[model samples]
Target: MKEEQKHIEALHDIKDMMNRSSRFISLSGLSGISAGLCALAATIYIWPVWLAVREKLRTGGDLQVYPYPATDVQRLLIMTGIVTFLTALLLALLFTWMRSRKTNTSMWGSTAKRLMTNTAIPLIAGGLVTYRLLDLELVGLIAPSCLIFYGLALLNGSKYTVSEIRWLGICEIILGIINLWFIGYGLVAWAIGFGVLHILYGALMWWKYERV
Candidate 1:
Protein backbone atom coordinates (compact mmCIF):
# COMPACT_ATOMS: atom_id res chain seq x y z
CA MET A 1 0.00 0.00 0.00
CA LYS A 2 2.82 2.42 0.83
CA GLU A 3 4.53 1.68 -2.44
CA GLU A 4 1.32 2.36 -4.37
CA GLN A 5 0.83 5.64 -2.53
CA LYS A 6 4.40 6.70 -3.34
CA HIS A 7 3.82 6.03 -7.03
CA ILE A 8 0.62 8.10 -7.04
CA GLU A 9 2.42 11.03 -5.38
CA ALA A 10 5.15 10.87 -7.98
CA LEU A 11 2.59 11.00 -10.77
CA HIS A 12 0.92 13.98 -9.20
CA ASP A 13 4.22 15.81 -8.86
CA ILE A 14 5.11 15.14 -12.46
CA LYS A 15 1.72 16.37 -13.63
CA ASP A 16 2.16 19.60 -11.67
CA MET A 17 5.60 20.20 -13.12
CA MET A 18 4.32 19.69 -16.63
CA ASN A 19 1.48 22.13 -16.10
CA ARG A 20 3.82 24.77 -14.72
CA SER A 21 6.15 24.43 -17.66
CA SER A 22 3.41 24.55 -20.26
CA ARG A 23 1.33 27.34 -18.77
CA PHE A 24 1.89 30.81 -17.40
CA ILE A 25 0.07 30.07 -14.13
CA SER A 26 1.34 33.02 -12.16
CA LEU A 27 -1.54 35.35 -13.05
CA SER A 28 -2.97 36.86 -9.88
CA GLY A 29 -6.66 37.32 -9.26
CA LEU A 30 -6.11 40.73 -7.71
CA SER A 31 -4.99 41.90 -11.11
CA GLY A 32 -8.43 41.26 -12.50
CA ILE A 33 -10.07 42.91 -9.50
CA SER A 34 -7.93 45.98 -9.91
CA ALA A 35 -8.78 46.21 -13.58
CA GLY A 36 -12.46 45.88 -12.87
CA LEU A 37 -12.25 48.61 -10.28
CA CYS A 38 -10.51 50.93 -12.66
CA ALA A 39 -13.16 50.26 -15.28
CA LEU A 40 -15.94 50.91 -12.81
CA ALA A 41 -14.29 54.13 -11.77
CA ALA A 42 -14.01 55.25 -15.34
CA THR A 43 -17.59 54.31 -15.95
CA ILE A 44 -18.80 56.34 -12.99
CA TYR A 45 -16.78 59.33 -14.04
CA ILE A 46 -18.24 59.16 -17.52
CA TRP A 47 -21.81 58.35 -16.63
CA PRO A 48 -23.05 61.90 -17.02
CA VAL A 49 -21.26 62.28 -20.29
CA TRP A 50 -22.70 58.98 -21.36
CA LEU A 51 -26.16 60.18 -20.52
CA ALA A 52 -25.59 63.34 -22.47
CA VAL A 53 -24.12 61.55 -25.46
CA ARG A 54 -26.92 59.05 -25.73
CA GLU A 55 -29.57 61.66 -25.13
CA LYS A 56 -28.13 63.83 -27.86
CA LEU A 57 -27.76 60.91 -30.18
CA ARG A 58 -31.34 59.97 -29.55
CA THR A 59 -32.64 63.46 -30.37
CA GLY A 60 -29.90 65.29 -32.25
CA GLY A 61 -29.47 65.38 -36.03
CA ASP A 62 -28.16 62.20 -37.60
CA LEU A 63 -25.14 63.82 -39.20
CA GLN A 64 -22.79 62.87 -36.28
CA VAL A 65 -22.39 62.26 -32.55
CA TYR A 66 -19.60 64.65 -31.64
CA PRO A 67 -16.89 67.00 -32.92
CA TYR A 68 -19.29 68.65 -35.33
CA PRO A 69 -18.74 71.92 -33.53
CA ALA A 70 -16.14 70.35 -31.21
CA THR A 71 -17.03 69.40 -27.65
CA ASP A 72 -15.06 68.36 -24.57
CA VAL A 73 -17.17 65.28 -23.78
CA GLN A 74 -15.88 63.34 -26.75
CA ARG A 75 -12.29 64.12 -25.90
CA LEU A 76 -12.96 63.51 -22.22
CA LEU A 77 -14.30 59.99 -22.73
CA ILE A 78 -11.46 59.13 -25.09
CA MET A 79 -8.88 60.31 -22.62
CA THR A 80 -10.62 58.48 -19.79
CA GLY A 81 -10.69 55.29 -21.78
CA ILE A 82 -7.01 55.59 -22.63
CA VAL A 83 -6.12 56.24 -19.03
CA THR A 84 -8.30 53.41 -17.76
CA PHE A 85 -6.81 50.94 -20.22
CA LEU A 86 -3.23 51.91 -19.36
CA THR A 87 -3.88 51.81 -15.64
CA ALA A 88 -5.47 48.39 -15.80
CA LEU A 89 -2.65 47.05 -17.96
CA LEU A 90 0.03 48.35 -15.61
CA LEU A 91 -1.68 46.93 -12.55
CA ALA A 92 -2.23 43.59 -14.21
CA LEU A 93 1.44 43.35 -15.18
CA LEU A 94 2.55 44.32 -11.70
CA PHE A 95 0.31 41.75 -10.04
CA THR A 96 1.31 39.02 -12.45
CA TRP A 97 4.97 39.78 -11.84
CA MET A 98 4.47 39.65 -8.10
CA ARG A 99 2.69 36.33 -8.35
CA SER A 100 5.40 34.96 -10.60
CA ARG A 101 8.00 35.91 -8.03
CA LYS A 102 6.03 34.31 -5.26
CA THR A 103 5.61 31.14 -7.27
CA ASN A 104 9.28 31.08 -8.24
CA THR A 105 8.48 31.19 -11.90
CA SER A 106 9.68 33.35 -14.76
CA MET A 107 7.08 35.87 -15.89
CA TRP A 108 8.23 35.78 -19.49
CA GLY A 109 8.67 32.58 -21.47
CA SER A 110 7.60 30.87 -24.67
CA THR A 111 4.21 30.10 -23.18
CA ALA A 112 3.69 33.73 -22.25
CA LYS A 113 4.71 34.84 -25.71
CA ARG A 114 2.24 32.51 -27.32
CA LEU A 115 -0.50 33.73 -25.03
CA MET A 116 0.25 37.35 -25.82
CA THR A 117 0.40 36.77 -29.55
CA ASN A 118 -2.89 34.93 -29.65
CA THR A 119 -4.62 37.56 -27.56
CA ALA A 120 -3.06 40.54 -29.33
CA ILE A 121 -4.25 39.64 -32.78
CA PRO A 122 -7.90 39.83 -31.86
CA LEU A 123 -7.39 42.94 -29.70
CA ILE A 124 -5.56 44.81 -32.44
CA ALA A 125 -8.15 43.85 -34.99
CA GLY A 126 -10.90 44.93 -32.64
CA GLY A 127 -9.21 48.26 -32.02
CA LEU A 128 -9.03 49.00 -35.72
CA VAL A 129 -12.66 48.06 -36.19
CA THR A 130 -13.62 50.27 -33.27
CA TYR A 131 -11.73 53.18 -34.82
CA ARG A 132 -13.69 52.73 -38.01
CA LEU A 133 -16.94 52.60 -36.10
CA LEU A 134 -16.04 55.88 -34.42
CA ASP A 135 -15.14 57.42 -37.73
CA LEU A 136 -18.57 56.47 -39.06
CA GLU A 137 -20.34 57.54 -35.86
CA LEU A 138 -21.95 54.18 -35.28
CA VAL A 139 -21.63 54.70 -31.56
CA GLY A 140 -24.38 52.30 -30.63
CA LEU A 141 -22.46 49.20 -31.71
CA ILE A 142 -19.15 50.15 -30.18
CA ALA A 143 -19.66 48.75 -26.71
CA PRO A 144 -20.99 45.41 -27.88
CA SER A 145 -18.15 45.18 -30.35
CA CYS A 146 -15.56 45.81 -27.67
CA LEU A 147 -17.08 43.21 -25.38
CA ILE A 148 -17.15 40.57 -28.08
CA PHE A 149 -13.59 41.18 -29.19
CA TYR A 150 -12.23 41.29 -25.65
CA GLY A 151 -14.02 38.06 -24.91
CA LEU A 152 -12.49 36.51 -28.01
CA ALA A 153 -9.07 37.65 -26.91
CA LEU A 154 -9.61 36.11 -23.49
CA LEU A 155 -10.70 32.84 -25.06
CA ASN A 156 -7.70 32.87 -27.35
CA GLY A 157 -5.31 33.42 -24.47
CA SER A 158 -7.03 31.22 -21.91
CA LYS A 159 -5.27 28.14 -23.21
CA TYR A 160 -2.02 29.34 -21.63
CA THR A 161 -3.60 30.22 -18.31
CA VAL A 162 -6.38 29.23 -15.95
CA SER A 163 -9.40 27.45 -17.33
CA GLU A 164 -11.82 29.87 -15.67
CA ILE A 165 -10.82 32.64 -18.05
CA ARG A 166 -12.50 30.78 -20.85
CA TRP A 167 -15.74 30.94 -18.97
CA LEU A 168 -15.24 34.61 -18.38
CA GLY A 169 -14.73 35.03 -22.09
CA ILE A 170 -17.96 33.26 -22.82
CA CYS A 171 -19.80 35.44 -20.37
CA GLU A 172 -18.40 38.57 -21.95
CA ILE A 173 -19.40 37.44 -25.40
CA ILE A 174 -22.93 36.64 -24.27
CA LEU A 175 -23.27 39.94 -22.49
CA GLY A 176 -22.02 41.79 -25.51
CA ILE A 177 -24.56 40.10 -27.72
CA ILE A 178 -27.28 40.98 -25.29
CA ASN A 179 -26.08 44.56 -25.19
CA LEU A 180 -26.70 44.80 -28.90
CA TRP A 181 -30.44 44.71 -28.25
CA PHE A 182 -30.13 47.79 -26.10
CA ILE A 183 -28.23 50.01 -28.49
CA GLY A 184 -28.49 53.18 -26.49
CA TYR A 185 -26.75 51.76 -23.42
CA GLY A 186 -23.26 51.36 -24.78
CA LEU A 187 -21.46 52.81 -21.82
CA VAL A 188 -23.56 50.80 -19.42
CA ALA A 189 -22.71 47.66 -21.29
CA TRP A 190 -19.10 48.65 -21.30
CA ALA A 191 -19.14 49.10 -17.56
CA ILE A 192 -20.77 45.74 -16.93
CA GLY A 193 -18.54 43.88 -19.37
CA PHE A 194 -15.20 45.32 -18.32
CA GLY A 195 -15.93 46.22 -14.72
CA VAL A 196 -18.43 43.79 -13.24
CA LEU A 197 -17.37 40.69 -15.12
CA HIS A 198 -13.68 41.17 -14.45
CA ILE A 199 -14.23 41.58 -10.73
CA LEU A 200 -16.39 38.47 -10.62
CA TYR A 201 -13.82 36.45 -12.51
CA GLY A 202 -11.02 37.74 -10.34
CA ALA A 203 -12.83 36.87 -7.16
CA LEU A 204 -13.50 33.39 -8.45
CA MET A 205 -9.89 32.89 -9.46
CA TRP A 206 -8.64 33.98 -6.06
CA TRP A 207 -11.08 31.73 -4.28
CA LYS A 208 -10.28 28.74 -6.45
CA TYR A 209 -6.51 29.05 -6.70
CA GLU A 210 -5.22 31.09 -3.78
CA ARG A 211 -7.66 30.26 -1.01
CA VAL A 212 -5.13 28.16 0.79
Candidate 2:
Protein backbone atom coordinates (compact mmCIF):
# COMPACT_ATOMS: atom_id res chain seq x y z
CA MET A 1 0.00 0.00 0.00
CA LYS A 2 2.80 2.44 0.87
CA GLU A 3 4.66 1.71 -2.39
CA GLU A 4 1.49 2.19 -4.41
CA GLN A 5 0.92 5.62 -2.85
CA LYS A 6 4.46 6.69 -3.69
CA HIS A 7 3.97 5.67 -7.32
CA ILE A 8 0.75 7.66 -7.57
CA GLU A 9 2.39 10.77 -6.14
CA ALA A 10 5.28 10.44 -8.55
CA LEU A 11 2.90 10.16 -11.49
CA HIS A 12 1.08 13.30 -10.41
CA ASP A 13 4.36 15.21 -10.15
CA ILE A 14 5.33 14.17 -13.67
CA LYS A 15 2.01 15.32 -15.01
CA ASP A 16 2.43 18.67 -13.30
CA MET A 17 5.88 19.10 -14.81
CA MET A 18 4.62 18.29 -18.29
CA ASN A 19 1.87 20.88 -17.93
CA ARG A 20 4.34 23.57 -16.94
CA SER A 21 6.60 22.94 -19.92
CA SER A 22 3.90 22.80 -22.58
CA ARG A 23 3.38 25.92 -24.72
CA PHE A 24 -0.20 25.64 -25.94
CA ILE A 25 -2.05 25.58 -22.63
CA SER A 26 -2.64 29.30 -22.17
CA LEU A 27 -3.68 29.78 -25.77
CA SER A 28 -7.41 30.01 -26.29
CA GLY A 29 -8.97 29.27 -29.65
CA LEU A 30 -11.90 31.58 -29.02
CA SER A 31 -9.51 34.43 -28.46
CA GLY A 32 -8.03 33.89 -31.90
CA ILE A 33 -11.48 34.00 -33.44
CA SER A 34 -12.37 37.15 -31.58
CA ALA A 35 -9.19 38.90 -32.62
CA GLY A 36 -9.75 37.96 -36.23
CA LEU A 37 -13.27 39.31 -36.16
CA CYS A 38 -12.02 42.56 -34.67
CA ALA A 39 -9.39 42.92 -37.37
CA LEU A 40 -11.93 42.37 -40.10
CA ALA A 41 -14.23 44.94 -38.56
CA ALA A 42 -11.46 47.46 -38.20
CA THR A 43 -10.44 46.93 -41.82
CA ILE A 44 -13.97 47.43 -43.07
CA TYR A 45 -14.24 50.61 -41.05
CA ILE A 46 -10.93 51.99 -42.35
CA TRP A 47 -11.19 50.99 -46.02
CA PRO A 48 -13.46 53.70 -47.35
CA VAL A 49 -11.33 56.39 -45.82
CA TRP A 50 -8.22 54.84 -47.31
CA LEU A 51 -9.82 54.68 -50.75
CA ALA A 52 -10.87 58.31 -50.64
CA VAL A 53 -7.35 59.41 -49.72
CA ARG A 54 -5.84 57.32 -52.47
CA GLU A 55 -8.22 58.69 -55.07
CA LYS A 56 -7.32 62.21 -54.05
CA LEU A 57 -3.62 61.44 -54.28
CA ARG A 58 -4.06 59.89 -57.73
CA THR A 59 -5.91 62.98 -58.95
CA GLY A 60 -3.12 65.32 -57.83
CA GLY A 61 -5.52 66.94 -55.43
CA ASP A 62 -4.52 68.54 -52.15
CA LEU A 63 -3.75 66.06 -49.35
CA GLN A 64 -3.64 68.54 -46.52
CA VAL A 65 -6.38 66.93 -44.47
CA TYR A 66 -5.21 63.34 -44.89
CA PRO A 67 -2.41 63.91 -42.31
CA TYR A 68 -0.02 61.52 -44.00
CA PRO A 69 1.65 64.00 -46.33
CA ALA A 70 2.09 66.86 -43.87
CA THR A 71 2.55 65.20 -40.52
CA ASP A 72 6.06 64.04 -39.83
CA VAL A 73 6.53 60.36 -40.48
CA GLN A 74 7.13 59.85 -36.77
CA ARG A 75 3.58 61.00 -36.06
CA LEU A 76 2.21 58.44 -38.48
CA LEU A 77 4.44 55.93 -36.75
CA ILE A 78 2.94 56.91 -33.44
CA MET A 79 -0.48 56.19 -34.86
CA THR A 80 0.66 52.76 -35.96
CA GLY A 81 2.13 52.21 -32.52
CA ILE A 82 -1.14 53.16 -30.88
CA VAL A 83 -3.07 50.78 -33.11
CA THR A 84 -0.67 47.94 -32.44
CA PHE A 85 -0.76 48.53 -28.71
CA LEU A 86 -4.55 48.57 -28.62
CA THR A 87 -4.73 45.37 -30.63
CA ALA A 88 -2.28 43.69 -28.28
CA LEU A 89 -4.25 44.82 -25.26
CA LEU A 90 -7.46 43.47 -26.70
CA LEU A 91 -5.87 40.11 -27.51
CA ALA A 92 -4.22 39.95 -24.11
CA LEU A 93 -7.58 40.44 -22.42
CA LEU A 94 -9.10 37.70 -24.53
CA PHE A 95 -6.23 35.37 -23.68
CA THR A 96 -6.56 36.16 -20.01
CA TRP A 97 -10.27 35.49 -19.95
CA MET A 98 -9.98 32.25 -21.85
CA ARG A 99 -7.11 30.96 -19.75
CA SER A 100 -9.00 31.75 -16.55
CA ARG A 101 -11.87 29.52 -17.59
CA LYS A 102 -9.80 26.81 -19.27
CA THR A 103 -6.93 26.29 -16.88
CA ASN A 104 -5.69 27.04 -13.39
CA THR A 105 -2.63 28.75 -14.74
CA SER A 106 -2.41 32.54 -14.79
CA MET A 107 -2.22 34.17 -18.24
CA TRP A 108 0.00 36.91 -16.87
CA GLY A 109 2.59 34.47 -15.66
CA SER A 110 6.25 34.45 -16.72
CA THR A 111 5.57 32.43 -19.86
CA ALA A 112 3.08 34.95 -21.21
CA LYS A 113 5.36 37.83 -20.34
CA ARG A 114 8.20 36.24 -22.28
CA LEU A 115 5.99 35.49 -25.25
CA MET A 116 4.76 39.08 -25.51
CA THR A 117 8.18 40.64 -25.22
CA ASN A 118 9.69 38.29 -27.78
CA THR A 119 6.91 38.79 -30.28
CA ALA A 120 6.32 42.50 -29.80
CA ILE A 121 9.80 43.94 -29.78
CA PRO A 122 10.64 42.87 -33.32
CA LEU A 123 7.23 43.89 -34.64
CA ILE A 124 7.48 47.37 -33.14
CA ALA A 125 10.97 47.89 -34.48
CA GLY A 126 10.03 46.73 -37.96
CA GLY A 127 6.92 48.91 -37.98
CA LEU A 128 8.95 51.99 -37.09
CA VAL A 129 11.36 51.24 -39.87
CA THR A 130 8.57 50.75 -42.34
CA TYR A 131 7.03 54.09 -41.34
CA ARG A 132 10.31 55.88 -41.88
CA LEU A 133 10.68 54.38 -45.31
CA LEU A 134 7.13 55.32 -46.19
CA ASP A 135 7.75 58.88 -45.05
CA LEU A 136 10.66 59.17 -47.42
CA GLU A 137 8.31 58.19 -50.26
CA LEU A 138 10.37 55.07 -50.73
CA VAL A 139 7.17 53.20 -50.23
CA GLY A 140 6.80 50.52 -52.84
CA LEU A 141 8.19 47.76 -50.65
CA ILE A 142 7.22 48.80 -47.18
CA ALA A 143 4.12 46.68 -46.71
CA PRO A 144 5.79 43.45 -47.78
CA SER A 145 8.76 44.11 -45.56
CA CYS A 146 6.48 44.77 -42.63
CA LEU A 147 4.61 41.56 -43.20
CA ILE A 148 7.75 39.51 -43.54
CA PHE A 149 9.26 40.86 -40.36
CA TYR A 150 6.04 40.46 -38.45
CA GLY A 151 5.88 36.86 -39.62
CA LEU A 152 9.45 36.36 -38.51
CA ALA A 153 8.49 37.51 -35.05
CA LEU A 154 5.58 35.12 -35.01
CA LEU A 155 7.67 32.20 -36.22
CA ASN A 156 10.41 32.97 -33.75
CA GLY A 157 7.98 32.98 -30.87
CA SER A 158 5.97 29.97 -32.01
CA LYS A 159 7.78 27.59 -29.67
CA TYR A 160 5.96 29.29 -26.83
CA THR A 161 2.57 28.87 -28.51
CA VAL A 162 0.60 26.60 -30.79
CA SER A 163 2.09 25.02 -33.88
CA GLU A 164 -0.82 26.34 -35.90
CA ILE A 165 0.45 29.84 -35.23
CA ARG A 166 3.75 28.95 -36.86
CA TRP A 167 1.94 27.80 -39.97
CA LEU A 168 0.09 31.10 -40.05
CA GLY A 169 3.40 32.88 -39.77
CA ILE A 170 4.69 30.97 -42.75
CA CYS A 171 1.62 31.93 -44.73
CA GLU A 172 2.13 35.57 -43.85
CA ILE A 173 5.68 35.44 -45.14
CA ILE A 174 4.52 33.97 -48.42
CA LEU A 175 1.74 36.53 -48.74
CA GLY A 176 4.21 39.28 -48.05
CA ILE A 177 6.37 38.11 -50.90
CA ILE A 178 3.43 38.06 -53.25
CA ASN A 179 2.43 41.50 -52.08
CA LEU A 180 5.56 42.90 -53.65
CA TRP A 181 3.96 42.70 -57.09
CA PHE A 182 1.00 44.73 -55.87
CA ILE A 183 2.85 47.77 -54.65
CA GLY A 184 0.20 50.22 -55.76
CA TYR A 185 -2.33 48.32 -53.71
CA GLY A 186 -0.56 48.61 -50.39
CA LEU A 187 -3.63 49.48 -48.32
CA VAL A 188 -5.59 46.58 -49.78
CA ALA A 189 -2.69 44.25 -49.21
CA TRP A 190 -2.39 45.35 -45.62
CA ALA A 191 -6.08 44.77 -45.12
CA ILE A 192 -5.93 41.27 -46.55
CA GLY A 193 -2.78 40.31 -44.71
CA PHE A 194 -3.61 41.52 -41.24
CA GLY A 195 -7.38 41.62 -41.43
CA VAL A 196 -8.37 38.66 -43.55
CA LEU A 197 -5.62 36.33 -42.44
CA HIS A 198 -6.41 36.82 -38.78
CA ILE A 199 -10.09 36.09 -39.38
CA LEU A 200 -9.33 32.85 -41.18
CA TYR A 201 -6.79 31.71 -38.65
CA GLY A 202 -9.03 32.59 -35.76
CA ALA A 203 -11.98 30.77 -37.23
CA LEU A 204 -9.94 27.65 -37.76
CA MET A 205 -8.62 27.75 -34.23
CA TRP A 206 -12.07 28.31 -32.80
CA TRP A 207 -13.60 25.49 -34.75
CA LYS A 208 -10.84 23.06 -33.95
CA TYR A 209 -10.14 23.81 -30.29
CA GLU A 210 -12.92 25.88 -28.79
CA ARG A 211 -16.10 24.32 -30.11
CA VAL A 212 -16.26 21.62 -27.51
Model 2 C-alpha lDDT per residue in residues 159-210, reported as the tens digit of each score:
7766688987888888888887766576667667776787788778778766
Count of backbone collisions within predicted model 1: 0
Instruction: In model 2, state the lDDT of residue 165.
Output: 87
Give all TM-scores, in the order shown: 0.94, 0.75
Give lDDT tens digits, candidate 1, residues 22-134: 88898999899999999999999989878777666667765234323235776787899999999999999999998889988888888788788989999999999988887
- Worst lDDT 10-window in candidate 1: 62-71
TM-score of 2: 0.75
| Cα displacement (Å) at residue 81, model 1 | 0.6
Runs in model 2 lying further than 4 Å from the true structure: 1-19, 22-24, 59-81, 84-88
